[model samples]
Target: MEFFAVLIAWGAVQFWGSGAIVQSDDWFVALRRSLRKINGAVPRLLLTLSPLLLVALVLFLLGPILFGLPAFIISVVILLYSLGRGDFHIQLRLYLNSWQRGDLEGARRHGEYFDPELRTGAENALQLHQAVRKGVFYHGFERWFAVVFWFFLAGPVFALAYRLLFLIARHEDSEQRERDMAFQGLYYFEYLPARLLGFAFALIGHFDRCFPVWRQLSVAELPSDDYLDQLGATCLPGVSAEEAQDDSAFLQRASDELQAAQQMLSRSLLCWVGVMALIELF
Candidate 1:
């Protein structure tokens, strides 16, 4: 447990490091390629990789004190490994650049670089494009932030394992029905944690609105595809998860008429600030 302090420090460092280095190609390109290989591997291969990773993690964990390496060094090793996850942030950078470039469609296309399925689900080119950007906040907090935050709280191995588990969980194969089963399992894991992430944002941004909104949103029945979460994000000032998830038909009855999207934008930030304050408080 002596290394626990290292774990916490490493978590903070890696989180900040990610924000700093997300634009670099060195980590993202390598990670995407490596993950693609791992993705193509059989499940049994992952089982094999898991134990090996475990061994390596344990060695570094215990080696720091016993073998003369410093704890900070050990922590740096773990964070460096995480920073190898370059592909995860490439689309994000692209999305941001697109916005900077006034290329809304480019931004949208870049955002959904993850799954072809999600990319296809949007009603039209525009909806598909926009959904990707709207989805970024979720990915930013959930997949990147919370996953790392929780993992580093544990250890390098724990963090890597958690992410690997989710990556494996997200894989859909030949069986169409099985995909739903896997998705269900995925959400099950995310249920409480995702809410916790919201709480974290609440802690950071709005100390005033943090806990109460977190509690309220926790019980709120989110929409299909977690649309309720989006609506709740609309609970933030000026932010509109509703517009983010709007229909492509241009004429069809929009499914997310809960409120003005501009308001949703503002409210989402309020919620974010609130979650951040919550994190700071507790």
Candidate 2:
């Protein structure tokens, strides 16, 4: 039943695209406002999220009474909502088109949509390519892997909670301590899922090359943005600086790398679905 719900949500994502339904930032705004009224970070987070959590809990409880359909529907809706608030593939396509057209400025501008800190000013095309690829992989982990993980681990309610925590960490602009607290909460929640996804990426991609890197990385390194960034790049087909014989070759290789990365991610996603289906069968 959970697997079916995931399949339904995945189909919806394919047919409608994740961007068709716009999830409002208004809730986050309200939560942030409410948090400001609180004294401590943990209290602030809890108070702001408690109501939604309660509502989600109520919905989950209704599932058994309603013959599991309600739970299934709730899972689908929450999974869709939790799969990031934007269209991941669309932005990647736009970035690729811009890069192929020799529009470095456009690529950088689009890249910022994924990561505001992306260093677009680098004259080295490879550097810019690496930065953008890193951003895409990290965001992919956040948007897709984390949501599906929590959904399977618990239920729709926890999935929704995870997404809320992620939004708080991503969108809230606050003092160092507050930001640190929010991010720490997100980091801890994502720790297991991220490693799992990294392992899957290795299995589905260049495993001999990717798995060793996955093994050698320390616990301290595993949870950071750099881990996924590096893992994704290494796991996918290699794109070397030597490939950049000229500007055109450099741009072409970068485009190829991005496409390869996208394909790798898609395969990893399929691997996840397959694993889930096997679990469901057994």
Candidate 3:
């Protein structure tokens, strides 16, 4: 199917988004960010926990074209859609701009983009400003990895899953139980694919360095299910539990500490794309 091929190409195109590229990705970013802004913790959590079958049904209706859509058109749409919207660039600019202008107050205001609950406080005070910001970060990951990863593996299935999972994650309240259920599934869904993505990163970047680090990440208590754990174990060497926990804890605290995690993530994205390019060339 051309659509399927389109999905593959879309998956392969992994340009690191610069300040200039933000406007182009405005669409997908906006769609997700808006849904997330409305959903918040309770709602989004519920959506993630929903039954996969139910999730499938919803995805089919909205993203049917993904499976059946023409490759050429699918290629165009995904690219158009991939451009981030929402407050991601706006917020990024705000924070960056504030820092550049020496606007501490401005920067603090911008920093509010992080999740309020998780943000609890800013020993820095800047990162804790908004839950939506976590939304921004989430959207960043969404467009950058989550959406495209699914698209390549199963075409429309990816689109449907992201939408369904995102919907569940976006809901709230008396429905907390439902939200929890939805949230739970997402944890399971990304289990295998996430590590596969990690492997792709290792392949593309400093393959030697990346592989060893990824092995370390496998044992590192970052998060996810047995599938993820198994994959990590198979691909990565091993790490002491205590040390991995410490690594996880440290990464969780300082966003700066996450530099390694970010590199790991980026390396994965770049490698996956580069590999796809190679496959297509062959």
Candidate 4:
């Protein structure tokens, strides 16, 4: 049932591109606002997690109904809702269009949408481009791989929890302390999945070059973004520091690298699905 839920949800996301109807966060924003009126950290935290609790309660109540058919349907809905909020491929296309046209400023502006922090840093076009590349890889991991990982490991509950924590951590109006705590929770949730995704990158990419980096970082406390950046750079076919140093063709090379990164991400996801199918079979 879990396998079928994942398969159906993956197909639905591909067909609908972002699944906006199920991915809406207006309710979350409202819930957060109401929770803010409560005193005490514990109470606020419990209120914040009430949605997840409600989901768990519903699944529990539905578990035995019609041989679990209703639960399966609910699982599919949760999985779809837990997916990343935006159309990543479209965003990548816009960034690439600006980049390939030799519009450095325009590309940087597009890149800022990927990582808002890019607005403050990235002294030059090269630096900005590199930051954008890292952003691309990180977004792919968090938006897809991480969600799928939790869903496969536990169920819809963990998947929803991961997405909720991500939203809290990234919420602009969230209190600093609340965001910090959410980030801490995210780190714990992401650690294992990040490593697993890195391993998948090694298998589907340049294994000889990427495997060593993956193994080396397995025990390190490196954040998921930096960890994926290191492994992704090593795995991509034509990516190298020297390519970025070339002034005349750097933009073209960066564009190619970005495309390669996207391909690697796709292949890694396929690899995971194949593995899961095998597991379901056996």
* Candidate maximizing lDDT: 4
Clashing residue pairs for model 4? none
Candidate 2 stretches with Cα past 4 Å from truth are 19-22, 119-123, 218-220
Q: Best candidate, TM-score-wise?
A: 4
Off by over 4 Å in 1: 1-49, 64-75, 82-84, 87-90, 96-104, 114-118, 124-126, 171-189, 203-213, 219-232, 238-282
For residues 204-247, could you state the per-residue lDDT of candidate 3 as single tens digits? Answer: 45577668766767556454433233332333333334533464
TM-score of each predicted structure versus truth: 0.53, 0.91, 0.52, 0.95
lDDT of each: 0.46, 0.77, 0.47, 0.85
Local accuracy of candidate 4 as per-residue lDDT tens digits, 156-268:
99999999989988887677777888888989999998998899989988788888889998789988999998889888855457867776578788888899999989988
lDDT of 2 by residue, 40-129 (tens): 767776775685767677776877876877767766776787788678899999999999999988898888767777643756667678
Higher-scoring candidate on lDDT, 1 or 3: 3
Better of 3 and 4 by TM-score: 4
Worst 10 residues of 1 by lDDT: 250-259
Instruction: Quote the lDDT for 255 in model 4.
Output: 87
Count of backbone clashes for each model? Answer: 38, 0, 38, 0
Error of 3 at 145 (Å): 1.1
